[model samples]
Target: MHFSSETRRDDGVVERDFTIGEIPGVLWTPEAAPTPVPLVLLGHPGGLRTMRPRLAARARSATRDGLAAATIELPGSGERPRGAKVDAVRAELRQALQTGEPVTPEIVDRLVLPLVEQAVPEWQTCLDALLELPEIGGPVGLSGGVISIGVRLAVVEPRIAAAVLFAGSFVPRVVLEEARRVTVPVHVLLQWDDEGNDRQVALDLFDALGSPEKSLYANLGGHTGVPAFAGEEAARFLARHLR
Candidate 1:
């Protein structure tokens, strides 16, 4: 188990990478003045396009107000290459065994829904590494399309304290039906005029959430900017809950 850390930024965004467990993640902290900060873990969208600068910038901007954010590439994307991704993920299981920590997957069938099933295990693995980081001693929040639908399903565990979802369409009905069981506070951010399935999907889940603290926001933008919205809102939300 080796760990690597680095920082990068153009303009006001600051990006850093932490390699823990078998997965190496690019953690983004805003370049603003240092402050004791909350940790926000961002789940990138599935497919090649999700691993891009725009999403990184979104996560970085959230830290501007005083928060620590990081994004880990799932098995086959970002800096985590496909060949070694699975072995890296399995390494997490071995590490968990050594630490006596529990690691579980929310979604199991990614072929049908690349968002939840394919990436949920990766999310769980990333969370495990994050909890061990010196700078990340706070509640965790998650947001992503299809890939992050597992966040709500992950409610059986208490480690995750908060979450914000943006245009997720993985298990619309199941997630909505089970939304109330999630004890953690959640927020759904979306585009009011979305012309795709995500709009309706997020809306339905938002309606089903039993948590009084949960709410939904339909932004002016469309799908592409959802991560940006989640990043910004997550900062505020984390400050209130984790800080």
Candidate 2:
């Protein structure tokens, strides 16, 4: 859906607009509440994409669970216009490849990493905006497409209550080890398929997690299907924890 000017549910949850750096975001919450409601910030996967259905489903579920939920259209998604700068980056990557020269780590770090870095602060700034709401609580939960990097960014802010990582991968072992410092609970959902990462390996890795309340849920299908389970489990988990 195109961004609304201001939207509200019959139950009194209001949807408001926010801007994180250059990125645009939206937050939803009940108009009347005794305290700040718990929140879940839904994040999109790597591709240039939008998952409005998934986000809407989560928002509805969170509303029922006495929590607030917000969905952000990441840097490249939604109505925001992309500029010539991005084209230049792509052109450089193309030129390097066309010349048969190896793409060095420095090139990737300098060019590609900045785009991803730009996205991280938008998520954090969205969380910052959500926290500003009168009905939102101190800690928030996240379910993102890029789990490893997402977790790194989320943990930077201690206010995050927990995180539900959906089929996340590409975790640096050093970073994964350091993630144990995150005090909040994390529920990692994984899919078992030859096309996907080895589900068992991912499960075992999370099973060894240092967080006190870490858990794992495994099922059939690819990256997208496992979130169906995360959707159900997230509702229950939020009720038990956030409530």
- Cα lDDT tens digits for candidate 2, 126-153: 7776677666885577765666555666
The 0-to-1 C-alpha lDDT of every candidate, in the order given, reads 0.59, 0.65
Candidate 2 wrongly placed segments (more than 4 Å)? 1-4, 10-12, 46-49, 78-116, 172-174, 194-201, 204-208, 227-230
RMSD versus native structure for model 1: 9.7
Error of 1 at 105 (Å): 21
Q: Which model scores highest in TM-score? A: 2
Q: Weakest 10 consecutive residues, lDDT, candidate 1?
A: 104-113
Q: Candidate 1 clashing pairs?
A: 16-27, 115-146, 115-147
Q: What C-alpha lDDT does candidate 2 achieve relative to the native structure?
A: 0.65
C-alpha root-mean-square deviation, each candidate: 9.7, 5.0
Error of 2 at 209 (Å): 3.7
Backbone collisions counted per model: 3, 3
